[model samples]
Target: MLLPFFEWCENTAIGETIRNSLWLFPVIEAVHLLALCLLGGSLLVVDLRMLGVGLKGQRISQVAGYARPFLIGSIVTLVCTGLLLFLSEAVKCYYNTSFWVKITTLPIALLLTFAVRDRFSLRKSFETSAMSRLLGAGSLTLWFVVAAAGRWIGFS
Candidate 1:
């Protein structure tokens, strides 16, 4: 159903330019990876706090608040660079199983991070619940699959 759109994206002028350029793809990929790292780190701090591992002294709300800007910024950066990267190889991604895995997991991961995890972490009370540990584990697992699938795309 979406194959035609992927074909159109790969044929876009900017996409062709990026695909043809020696440096553009590499630079964009580097930025994308850096953004991923930033995102992982930002989320990790809060997740660990929720798990009652690190930052025991700080409130979950405080850790989450501190990581908010970084989380938002990294996600923005990732989306921008990811679009450009996809534009360059949309058709290839369409055929790649790893790409399907990434696309499948990415939104779920984001939903967990922002909607469930972030909101849950923001309670004023310092009380840690069993749900917190579940959230932390689930967030980590989904994100790891997303990242790993993204990495597998290169090999695929």
Candidate 2:
């Protein structure tokens, strides 16, 4: 399904134009990297709070509320730029193991976010439970793997 869609994209005039631009991929990759930094930074703070490592005075909900916009913006930037890059090398990425690992981790991280969000409550939000700390550690590990896998794409 995705292959056909990607094939169509590869054949389109827009795709041709995008592919022909010598600097487009590099520019997109740079933006993706910058977005990654932003996302990681914001998530790190949130995770640290969850792990009882920082901002212990502030409520978890308060921290999450403040970071939500930054997190969403960074993720949006990452998605758009990442898709552009993937489109440029769709067929290759479709088979790359590192690419698969990175793609796989994305959903896991999202699921982790949903789990953490669901676990958050008025009273519970104030207390960083052990489960929350474990979840935070898991989220960090998954993101680390994703980043490492992405870097491996260059060599593999």
Candidate 3:
């Protein structure tokens, strides 16, 4: 079932172009990395504020609001470049455990961000709540795992 989709991806013109070009894969990979940096850096700033350790003067909502746009932009860029990169090696990634791990963790991390973490940041009482701190720490940990698994995909 999924095999045909992977085959189609690998045979697509975009995929073929990426696979054939000497610089395209590396360039996309670099873009993906840059997007990852933006996402991670922005998320970290907000998360650290949740943990009550950084941006001491600003409210949680203010800090999170400042980072939200960058976070959203990076997510879009990373997904686009990542999908292109994946198309070039769809069949290989389909069988890669690290790829599966990274894919699985990505949605979980995003859910943590938008569903759990954002709610915590929006609440004025969250600053003193233990659950808020836990969510912040967990969100950071999930994102870290996602990054590690993504890197592991190259080796696996």
Give me the candidate number with maximum lDDT.
1
Write candidate 3's Cα lDDT for 1-156 as tens digits: 788999999999999999999999999999999999999899888888878788878888888888989999999999999999999999999899999899999999989888888877866655635775787799899999999999998998
For each of the candidates, give the backbone clash count: 0, 0, 0
Top-down lDDT ranking: 1, 3, 2
**After superposition, which runs of candidate 1 have C-alpha atoms over 4 Å from their true positions?**
none
Best-fitting candidate, scored by TM-score? 1
Candidate 2 residue pairs in clash (backbone atoms < 3 Å): none
lDDT (C-alpha) at residue 57 in model 3: 85
Pick the winner on TM-score between candidates 1 and 2. 1
The 10-residue segment of model 3 with minimum total lDDT is: 123-132
Alpha-carbon error at 41 in model 2, in Å? 1.0
Model 3 residue 132 lDDT? 58
Full-model lDDT, candidate 3: 0.89
Quote the RMSD, in angstroms, for model 1: 1.0
